[model samples]
Target chain A: MKETLKLFKIGGGVLDDDAQLHRFVQAFAQVPGRKILVHGGGKGASQMLSDLGIAPQMVQGRRITDAATLDVVTMFYAGKTNKQLVALLQASGVNALGLSGADGNVIRAVKRPVKDIDYGFVGDLPANSVDAATLHTLIQAELTPVLCAITHDGHGQLLNTNADTIASTVARALAGRYEVELHYCFEKNGVLLDVNDDNSVIPQIVPAQYQQLKADGVIAAGMIPKLDNAFAALEAGVEKVVIEHALNINEPIKTVLCRS
Target chain B: MKETLKLFKIGGGVLDDDAQLHRFVQAFAQVPGRKILVHGGGKGASQMLSDLGIAPQMVQGRRITDAATLDVVTMFYAGKTNKQLVALLQASGVNALGLSGADGNVIRAVKRPVKDIDYGFVGDLPANSVDAATLHTLIQAELTPVLCAITHDGHGQLLNTNADTIASTVARALAGRYEVELHYCFEKNGVLLDVNDDNSVIPQIVPAQYQQLKADGVIAAGMIPKLDNAFAALEAGVEKVVIEHALNINEPIKTVLCRS
Candidate 1:
C-alpha cells in the first residue's frame, strides 16, 4: 500500500488573522505522514497596495493583476507570509520549507492568454505543470514543502496563481505515487445542507450525491466552483478531497468527497 | 577527493540594478558543478519601508532592526529579490530553490542578546548555525539553493541577518564536505591597490600580503571587515575566497585569497 500524502490549502480567512494562523499552524504541525501546505494571498497584500497608493485595476468586473500588484502579492504571499509560516512550523517542529513555483521549477505556468480581458501577470497551470518527481524527492528526504500561490512562466516572469488550483493540480500530479488527500481548509465547517446551520455538515459525498446536491440547490452557489474542482480532482485519481474549517482539521466534522 | 562547490555572495549594488543582476545571473548560470548563491537586500526594501511610513530606528548611530524594519526587509529580501533571482535562474536553465533560514531549519540563529543597545529582531548566528547535512542533501539532489539574508530564532521569530556573515558561515560549515570556494561579488573589479583605479586589481593575496597591505594603509577602511571575513572563512577550511565584480564573475581579473 502506498503511503498517504495530505495536502492542505489555506486561504485569506486563516492567513489574515495572526492568532488564527498560529493556531492553524500548531494544528497542522501535528498532522502525521508526508504533507504539503498551499496558501493563498491574504488581505494584507491589497492593504499594502492601497497604502502604497497603487489602485487596483479592474475590467469588466474582473480584477487585473498589474505589474505593481503582482510585486506586492509576491512579497506578501511568497515572502512575508510564507516565511512567517515556515518559521512557525519549524518552531512547532514540522521542518517546513517554503516555495514558489519558481523554486526548483516545481510548477511552471503559462501566462493567461490575452482575451477581451487582459489579466496581466496572471498564470494558468497547464497539464504536467507540477514537477512531481522533484516534489517526491523533497518529500522523501523528510521535508514538508509550503507552497505559495506564485508561479513562473519558466522564462523569468513571476505570475500570480490561484492556491486552490495549485492544491488540486499538485494532488493530481502526485496521485500516481501517493494516496493523495487534498484538504481545502476555510472558515466554514463543511458542505452544509442548510447554509445557515454550522452543524449541518454532510460527512461524505460521492460523485452521484454531489451531483444531486448541486441539482437540488442544496449547495451554496459560492461553493459550486470549488465543489466542481474537488470532484474533478477525485475523478482524476486523487484518493479523497476534504473540505473543513482551518482550525478544526484534526476534528472529525468535515465533508469528504470521493469517487464512487 | 571531495567534489567542488562554489558559493557566491552578492550585495546591494548588483541587486538594486536590474541589468546588472540579470547579467550576473547569466554569468552565474554558466558556472559548472554544485553551487549556492547568497544575496543581500537591495535599496528596494528601504524604499518600501519608507513608502509604508516605517521610520528606521537607530541607536547610538547604529541601525537597529526593529520589528517593523524586520518585516519590510524580510518581505523585500526573502520575497521579491529572492523569488526574482530564482525565476531568472530558472529561465537561465538552473534549478534554483529559494530559502530563508527558517526553511528546512537550514540556518537557525540566536536572537542577539541585549547589550548597551538593543537591536530588536536581529539574529546572530552561532557555531553550527548552518545545517550542512541538509544543504548537502539539497546540493546532491541537484537543486541550487538561493538564500536570502533572513534567519529565524527557531522559536517562530524571524530575524534580520547580515548577508556577508551568512555567506562565510555557510561556506565554513560546508568546507568539510566540499572543496568550497567563497565568492564575494560587488561593484569593484577586485581588491584594488589604488581605490580610484578600476584596473588595479590585485590578482592574488596571501595572509602575509594582506597583512602588509593593511599595515601600509593600501587597503581601504571599508574593505577591511569584508576581507577579514573572507580570510576567516579560508582559515576555517574553505579552499579559497574570491572577490570579484558581480557582472564579471566568469572573468579571470579578480582577487583570489588563499591560506599560505
Candidate 2:
C-alpha cells in the first residue's frame, strides 16, 4: 500500500493578505500526513519592482519576464515569502524546509522557446522536471517541503515558472511512489455551480460529468483550463485533486476530483 | 571511523565580487567528501536598503538591525545570495540545498535581549543552536547545504545573525558525528606575521604560540577575535580549523590552528 501525500498550492490572493495567510497557515498546520506546499508569487514582487524603478514589460496583454523582473521575483518568492512561510510553519510545529527548484536540482526547467514573443528568463517544465526520488526521501524523513515558483536550468540560469504547473508536475511525478492528492487552494470555495453563489460548490467532480458541464456551459470559461489540468493530473496517475479555499483546507467544504 | 566533513565559511569580500564568488564556488566544488558552505551578507543588502529609502540604524558606532533592516537582509542573504550560490554549485555538479536557520528548524536562535543597546531584530545563537541530526541526514543524502545568516526564534520571528558564529556553532555541533574541518575563507592569504606584507602567512599556530603572538602584538588586533573563535572551535572537538584565502582554497600556504 502506498502512503498518501497531500500537496497544496496557494496563490497570490492568500499570500498577499497577512490575516488570511496566517489563518491559512494555522489551518494548514492541522493537516495530517506527509504533505508539500507550493506557493505562487504574490504582489510583493511587483511592488518591489515598482519600488526599484523597474517597469513591467507586457506583450499582447501577457507579462514578459525580463532579467530584472526575474531577479526581483526570485528574491521575493524564493527568499522572503518562502522563508517566512517556513518559519511560520515551524512555529506551528511543522518540520518545514523551504526550497527553490535550484535547491537539490529538484526541478530543472528549460527556457521557453522563442516562438511568437520572446519571454525573457521564463521557463517551461519538460516531462521529467521534478525529481521524485529526492522529494520522496525528504517526505520519508518527516520534512514538509515548501517550494517556491523559481526553477533553474541545469546550466545555472534561474527561470520564472508558473506555480500551478509546478504543483501538478510535482504531483504527477510523486504519484508512482505515493497516493498523491493535489489541492489547489484559492479565494473561491470551489468550482461553483453558480458563479455568484459562494456556497454552490459542487461536492464532487469526475471526468465525464466535467465534460457534460463544459458542454452545457455551466462551468465558467476561466475554470475550464484549471479543470482540464486537474483531469490531466488524474490521467497522469495522481489519486485525487481538491479545490478549496486556502483558509478552509481542514474544513469539509471542497470539490474533490477523482479517477472514476 | 567518522567520515570527514569540511565546512567552509566565506564573508562579504568574495560575495560582493562576482568573479571571486564564482572562483570560490569552482574551487569548493573540486573538494572531495561531504562539505557545507556558510556565507555572510554582502553590500547588496545595504544597497537595497538605501535604494528602498531605509536608513541605517546605528548605535554607538555599531550597526543596529532595525525591523526594516532585518527584512531586507533576510531577503538578500537567504534569498538572492543563497539561491545564486546553490544554482552555481548545481551548475558545477554539486547537489546543493539553500537554507535559513528556520528551514528544518536547523538552527533556532533567541532574539538578543535589550542590553546597553537594544539591537532590534538581531539573534544570538545559544549553545544548542544547530541541529546536528538533521544536518547529518542532509549530508548523508549527498546534498550540500548552503546556509545564509538568517535564523529565527522558535516563536516565528526571523532574526539576523552573524555568519561567523553560525559556522563555528555548526562546526562545534557536528564534531561528534564527523571529523570536522572548519575553514574561514577571506581576502588575505592567511594570518600575517607582518601585517604589512600580504605574503607573510603563518603556516601553523598552536595555543602557546597564539598566546605569545598576542602578547608580542605580532598578530593584528583585527585578526584576534576571529583567531580566538577558531581556537575555541579546536578545543570544542573540531578536528582542524583553516584560515585561508577564498580564491586560493585549493592551493596551500594557509594558517592551520590545532589543539596540541
Candidate 3:
C-alpha cells in the first residue's frame, strides 16, 4: 500500500476573509499526514484590477482574462495570497513551500486556444502537465507544498488557470504513486440535498446515486460541472473525494465521494 | 572539498527592461555549476502603486514601506518579477524555483523597529535567518533558486526587504558549506576611476585600496556603503564579490573586490 496524500483546495470565500483564512490554515495544519494546498484568487485580485482602472473583459456570459487582468491575478494569487498562506502555515509549525506552476517546472500548461473567444492569458492543463516526481520528493522531504492558481507555458508566458482543475490534475497525476484524497473546501458545508437548508448535506455520494440525483433535480444546475469533475477524479484512481466547508474541515458533517 | 556556488543579484536596471532581463536569463542558464538568483523589485510596483492612488511614504529622504506600499511591492516583486524570471529561466532549460523568504520558511525576518523613523512593514534579517541547509538541499537537487525581496516574520506578516541585503546575507550564511561567489549586477560597467567615464572600469579593489580611494575622493559617497557591505561579506568568509554590468556579466571588464 502506498502512503496517503491529502490535497485540499480552498476557493474565494475563505480567502476573502482574513479571520476565516487563518482559521482554515490552523485547521489544515492539524491534518496529520502528507498534504498539499491549492488556493484560488479572491476578490482581492479583482479589487486591485478595478482600482488600477482595468475593466473586466467579458465575451458572452463568461469573463475573459485579458493581459492586464492576468497580471493582477498573478500578483494576487501567486504573490500575496500564496506567501501569506505559507507564512501562516509556518507559524503553525508546518514547513510549507509556496509555488506557482513555473516553480521547479511543476506544472507546464498551454494557453487556451481561441475558439469563439480569446481568453488572453488563460491556461489549460493537458495530460502529463504536472511534474509528479519533483512534487513527490518535496512531500517525502516533509514539506507541504502550497500551490497558487498560476501556471506558465514552457516558452515563458504566465497564464491564469482554474484552481479546481489544478487540484484535480495534481491529484490524478499523483494517484499512481500515492493514495490521493482530493478535498474541495468552499463556503457551504457539502453538497446539500435542499439548497436552502444548511443541515441537509448528503453524507456519502457515489456515481450512480449522483447521476440519479442530477436526473431527479436533487442536485442543482450549478453543481453538475463540479460533481462531474469530482467523479472524473475518482475515475482516475483517486482514493476518495471530499466536499466540506473551508472552516469546518475537521468536522464529520461533510460529504465523501467514493468509487463504489 | 565543497562545490562552488555562484549567487547573482540583479536590480531594477535589468528587471525593468524585458530584452535585458531575457538576455541575462539566457546568460545565467549557460553558466556552469550550482547557482542562485536574487532579484530586486523594478519600477513596475511603484507605477502600479501610483496608478492605484497609493502615495509612497517617505521619511527624511528615505522611502518608508507602509502597509499599502508593502502590499504593492510584495505583489510586484514576488508575483510578476519573480515568476517572469522563473519562466524565462525554465525556457532556457534551467529548473528554476522562485521563492520569497516566507516560502519554506527559508529566510525568517523581524519587522524593523520603530525608532526615529517608522518604516512600516519593512523587515530586517538577523543572524541565523537563512535556512542554509534547505538551500543546500535544493542546490544539490540541481534546482536553481530565484529569490525576490519579500520576507516574513514567523508570525505571518510579509515584510518588504532590501535585495542587496538579502543577497549578501544569503552569501554569508551559505559561506560555511559552499565556496560562494557573490555577484552584484547593475547598469554600470564597474566602479569607475572617473565617475563620468563609463569606460574607466577599475579591475579590482582591496579593502585598503577602497579606503584610500574614498579618502582620495575617487570613489563617490554613494558607492561607499555598497563597497563596505561587499567587503563585510568577504570578511565573513564569502570567497569573492564582483560588481559588473547586468547584461555584460559574461564579459571580463568588471570590478572584483577582495578582502586583502
TM-score (C-alpha, index-matched) for candidate 2: 0.99
Compute each candidate's TM-score over C-alphas.
0.99, 0.99, 0.98
Task: For candidate 1, give the lDDT of residue B259.
Answer: 96
Candidate 1 backbone collisions, by pair: none
TM-score of 1: 0.99
Give the per-prediction TM-score of chain B. Answer: 0.99, 0.99, 0.98
The CAPRI class of candidate 3 is high
Q: Which portions of model 3 miss their true places by more than 4 Å?
A: none
lDDT of 1 by residue, A71-125 (tens): 9999999999999999999999998999999999999999999989999999999
| lDDT for each residue of candidate 1 in B131-200, tens digit (9 for 90 to 100) | 9999999999999999999999899999999999999999999999999999999999999999999999
Per-candidate DockQ versus the true complex? Answer: 0.94, 0.85, 0.85
Residues B67-178 of candidate 2 have per-residue lDDT tens digits of 8888789889988999899999999999999999999999999999998989989889999999989988988999999999999998888999999999999999999999
DockQ of 1: 0.94
Compute the lDDT of residue B122 as modeled in candidate 2.
88
Docking quality band of candidate 1, CAPRI definitions: high
